[model samples]
Target: MIDQYSFLRPWLFCLDPEKAHNLTLSNLDRAERWGLLQRFITKPIADPHTLCGIQFPNPVGLAAGLDKDGKHIDSLAALGFGFLEIGTVTPRAQPGNPKPRMFRLPEAEGIINRMGFNNDGVDACVARVRKSKFWQSGGVLGLNIGKNASTPIEQASQDYVFAMAAVYEIASYITVNISSPNTQHLRSLQSEEMLRSLLHDLSEERKKLSDRYGVHKPLFLKIAPDLDQEDIHLIAELLVEFGIDAVIATNTTISRETVKGMEYGEEAGGLSGAPVRAASSQVIKTLKARLGNALPIIGVGGILSGADAREKVMAGASLIQLYSGLIYRGPELVNECANALRR
Candidate 1:
């Protein structure tokens, strides 16, 4: 069956990456509705790991960016991911960057994207998750929320708070995304002062929501891969100081070192794939070393195989996520990686 689908790759690859993505997602939605996806795909491995007080069946998770609006939770969960993170959703829905924004670096096993936090807004995303049969089946879902692109840096906290309030009731865990490079000055929020203030405000709001909803979901920080030692240390300190639950080390990186000579190498956006493996792992190692197990780390970036997943675990990641890898490898990649983790 996998071999038969291999023939479709050329046709699928012919389309622009963004269009192909939408078509694929739409097909999966239809498959679920027809009750065919579940019968064909292998069942997800149930390794049963715990993180942020939630029990995940396996350590391997589908990273954010693939399902921006939680629209295909059932389809994704059916593909054997241990957990699924949906969105870099903002307070309001907005069209992302212009066309040709998502580019594939097949030669480098990488992808360059300036997706710019595109999604159908927090309320819509929350509503879909609320209606998801997958969620009703007790699947673990993490909401990755970010500020709108036009929102000022100083006022970014308000956007985060708004998203949090909207999705707080439905999310098993919430990830605060402040590292995407496509948005102007978004990464600046990672600086010491900005990070401190942003996290402090969000932390206060998280507590309020927790009490109000009578549920204490873990609030994590999703960081970027393009940070220096000082930047990493400061962010680690902030995570500890602010009582943030976990840190998702290393979102897509702006550095094009991995895809330096590729066709889209010069594109202005974050690069994600095999090239980011070492950089992201280093961040995880640094964070774990700094936090000393005080906080759990969710490692993501450049994970293409089980070996990559194992390396992340050895480096101190309690959980692992993949985006580009899935695009290049297909659904079997998830089962293969999870099976490798068990060994």
Candidate 2:
């Protein structure tokens, strides 16, 4: 496949990171409308697989954050991802941090963004998802839910409950995203005390929703890569205790040791991309050792090429997702990673 991004990336890089992000999505949205996207896409190899009761056409998926409000789903889904995960949508709409919140660390091939779960409210996102052709197009859809920025930490569970119920019917699975560094005290939800309470509430609600809808949609927790062995072990134990469906091995990391001297290296958000690969894979390896097939693991972080993708699987990820890789390497990375897994 020709690398159209080779021509586009330089121009995109010249724009401010957030502006570039919006432009890429808007352009793809337009492309989908005109039915011109297929001309740019080279379909990935078939590697259909099942995880958490959902069938993914391949192991590679578009991670949440890229299409925060579910807009551009048809365009992104058409780019040959096995599935598409959208949003970290909260119960209510709220603008995120001020400008320059997102930054690029090209030297380390990482990005730091404190774009604190900036998304349309859950209701609005639900409307967008309902309108998107992808929901009805047989592609796997995972809706990621988060707490609103203004909501107090103690009241976080209410936001999660509201978002989960709002999208439960349409979601193939729901992602409990409590690890994004951008949200104040959000990672605290991962602590032993908060995590137990949070999962308990979500699990109980899921049971009722399961009975009501006659479908048990799986729920996965997107965790942080920065965790000690003790933390990982306890989190693994909690997964079994709560009967959680699957685990997305990592969100982004707050640690900056990897890119300390690079531009934007000290930015105040989770750092992602190549710098996150090792930490993310290590988490997967640790979880796999502890869980031992209790549930599937969807690995993500720093997957910029087929080799990087394979590293996550080799570390025991049953599946993988991408965000930064799609930015630097473009859609062809999807096929590259899918083919790597096929081999």
lDDT of each: 0.88, 0.91
Error of 1 at 139 (Å): 1.2
For model 2, residues 1-343, the per-residue Cα lDDT tens digits are 3368878998999999999999999988898788788876888878889887778889999899988998889999888999989998999998988888999888888889999888878899889888888887767999999999999999999999989999999998999999999999999999999999999999999999999999999999999999999999999999999999899989999999899778788879889999999999999999999999999899999999999989999999999999998888887888899999999
Candidate 2 residue-wise lDDT at 61: 94
TM-scores, all models, native as reference: 0.97, 0.98
Error of 1 at 267 (Å): 0.9
How well is each residue in 1-343 modelled by candidate 1, as lDDT tens digits? 2554467667888999999999988998898888887888776558999877899999889898899998899988888889999998999989988877998888888888998988899989988998898898888999999999888988999999999889898998999999999998999999988888988898899889989989888999999988998899989888989899999988999887677777888888889988899999999999888989798999999998889988898899998998888777777778878888898
Most lDDT-accurate candidate:
2
lDDT of 2: 0.91
Which segments of model 1 are wrong by more than 4 Å? none
Best by TM-score: 2
Model 1, poorest ten-residue lDDT window? 1-10
